[model samples]
Target: MRRREFVALTLPSVLVMFGFMLVPLYRTVEWSFERVSYGQAGTFVGLQNYLAALTEPRFGRAVVFTVGLTLVVTVVTICLGYLIATLVNGLGRMRPLVLGILLVSYVIPHVVGAVSFSWLFDSNFGGVANFLLGRLTGGDVLWFTDLWPNRLIIALNVIWSMLPFVMLMILAGLQGVSRETLEAAQIDGAGTLGRHWHVIIPSIRGVLGFAVLISTMDVLRTFDNLIPLAPQAVGLGNESIMLYIYNVAFREGAEDLGLGSAISVLTILIILVLLYPSIRSILKEAKEA
Candidate 1:
């Protein structure tokens, strides 16, 4: 294709992005400079929002919570996904059925999952967790009250919503693991666990890196289920940064635009920093391996 034709084909996307995303984003930066609603709107104050966001306890806690949730959920999803993929891959005829179940879970609406999770963790009698409590812990426990429980529920929800995709990717990676390679390894005296620990894992590192990148980015930005799941928790001033931004933009009261913009910019930076290394390593390994 000619350069001009290539440009023509790409022009519409470029134009749409500039018109919709860039224009509004630029205005958001402009808005962040002025004191708006958190106090009175006033003349430009360079870096005030950034400074305020840095100093604010709620924003600090939210940043910590957001990163922590991303870390916890990403680890859980990866581990669980790898385990599930391992189990399904060896199941022969059962593999397709298992994969189908995973697909259904993946396709379920988030709100529906949220409702299910709510029922499962209902502190009162007969919820699954509560029902099991008597058998294990001597009594039922409130799953959402304390800090660890709240975080656990949120992480579990994230892991549940996220695991199917992770598992699917892992399964794909497993499929790519050639049978000849496995047979060769087995002939060399590699046991099942040894093959997994060395051969399978090394072979799929790139896939895992890509999966981690996608999961971390998505999990960091997730808000809907998280917010509803932990509504009563003191603003850690958002359950996550996304939730914080939502509250700043659309909450019934206290819509502070500047703070939200500052936070949004910070959020973008946080994601970039988190993803840059994983992406770089993935590309590097793809080149090497």
Candidate 2:
């Protein structure tokens, strides 16, 4: 295709991306360096907002909670997703049905799913899960008011929501694994675990890496689920980075927009750092190809 045709075809999309993404990003960065609120002129504040975010004890707790949740959920989801994908891949006729069932959580909106999930544990809502656990362990678990228990439910909710996408990605990767390679590994006396660890995993390293990258980004920005699942997040130290930002910038009686924007910039940097290895590997693979 000619350059003119290429530019014509892509110009609209480029403009749309710039308008929707770059404009907001620029505004956020600008706001981060100024003392601003909604619909008011911002005064220059230099790095004061950033310094405040860094020094705030609540912000520190929010970072620790968010990062810890991201690590736990990402690792657990990848492992469980791979396992479920492997099992589903071996099915012949039931694959579609199994996948459909597994994808129900993924297809549901996060807030709706979280509300439904919370009902399963909230005794005020006649929570079946809490009842069963109480019968089994002889104690009522405080899923909302407590720190660790709330964290567990939040992590579980995140894993539940994210598992299907990861599994589907892995399942797609599994379809591209060579039958000949697997047979050769088996012929070489590799056991099931050995075959997975050596032949299958290495072949799908790129897919797994991509899954991890996406999952990490999603988990880092987790907010919707916490609305219902961790209502007491601020008090219990269960606040995610996004939630903290929301409380600071948008929540009633707290319109510290500059601090929120600073935290947003810092969160972006943290995500980039976390995803650097996976992104570098992808670039290397693309270059080699």
Candidate 3:
């Protein structure tokens, strides 16, 4: 393709994305600087809003929650993905069946998947946890009734939702591992664990790093599942950065667009900061590996 034609052909998508998405992202930065109310006009707040926002206890708790969730999700998803991909890679016939089941989740609507998973762990009737509690403890267990359990359920639900993506990515990475390298490890009498830890992992380290960064970013913005199944027996009151931002944007009379925009700008910054090292390391490795 000629350079001119290529630019002309791709110009529309560039326009659409910049107009619809990038414009709002910039506007958030603009709003973050001004003292804007939901429906009322206001003046420039300068850095005053930013200063106040950083000092808020809610912001601190939200940061703690977001960081904690991201850390847990990243570790769990990547580990599960590696293990599942290893099993699938070994199985000849089982690979396709197992992969198909997981791939179907990628296409499912987030809301539908969230609701379905919620029901599976529902406190009412015969959810899996209830059934297990009935069998093991002779009583029902209320997962959402306590803070730790409730947060754990939400985090686990995110893991369930995100695990398949990680698996698919790692499977692609695993496919890139040469048969020769694997054979070399086997020929050297390296056992399965040894081969995996030394040979297989280093070979696909770049993709694994990318997966961790992507999973962490996804966890940072996790709101879809938390929204429908929120403020239950435990309480979902502005628990995470994204959730807190949503509360500031739409909740009753306290809606502050400027504040919401500030939170969003900060959230984007946080994700970027967390992603930088892994992404940079991955790029460096790709250049060298």
Residue-pair clash count for candidate 2: 0
Which 10-residue window in model 3 sums to the lowest lDDT?
Answer: 229-238
**What is residue 207's positional error in candidate 1, in angstroms?**
0.4
Q: Compare candidates 1 and 2 on lDDT and give the better one.
A: 2
TM-score of each: 0.88, 0.95, 0.89
Candidate 1, residue 156: the lDDT equals: 85
Candidate 3 ranges beyond 4 A from true positions: 1-3, 232-238, 275-289
What are the per-model C-alpha RMSD values against the true structure?
Answer: 3.4, 1.7, 3.0
- Compared with the true structure, model 3 gives a TM-score of 0.89
Please report, as a residue range, the 10-residue window in candidate 2 with the lowest summed lDDT.
270-279
lDDT of 1 by residue, 30-95 (tens): 777876764455568889989998998877787889888889889988998999999988798877
Candidate 2 segments exceeding 4 Å error: 275-289
By lDDT, the better pick of 2 and 3 is 2
- Candidate 1 overall lDDT versus native: 0.81
lDDT of 3 by residue, 1-289 (tens): 8999999999999999999999988878888988887556668989877887899878887888778988998999899999998888888877778888987767787767778777776866358866776889897555666677678778888888899999989999999998998899899999999999999999999899889878877888888877655556214433777778877777788778888888888777877888788678779999997
Q: Which pairs of residues clash in candidate 3, taking residues 3 or more apart in a chain or in different chains?
A: none
Better of 1 and 3 by TM-score: 3
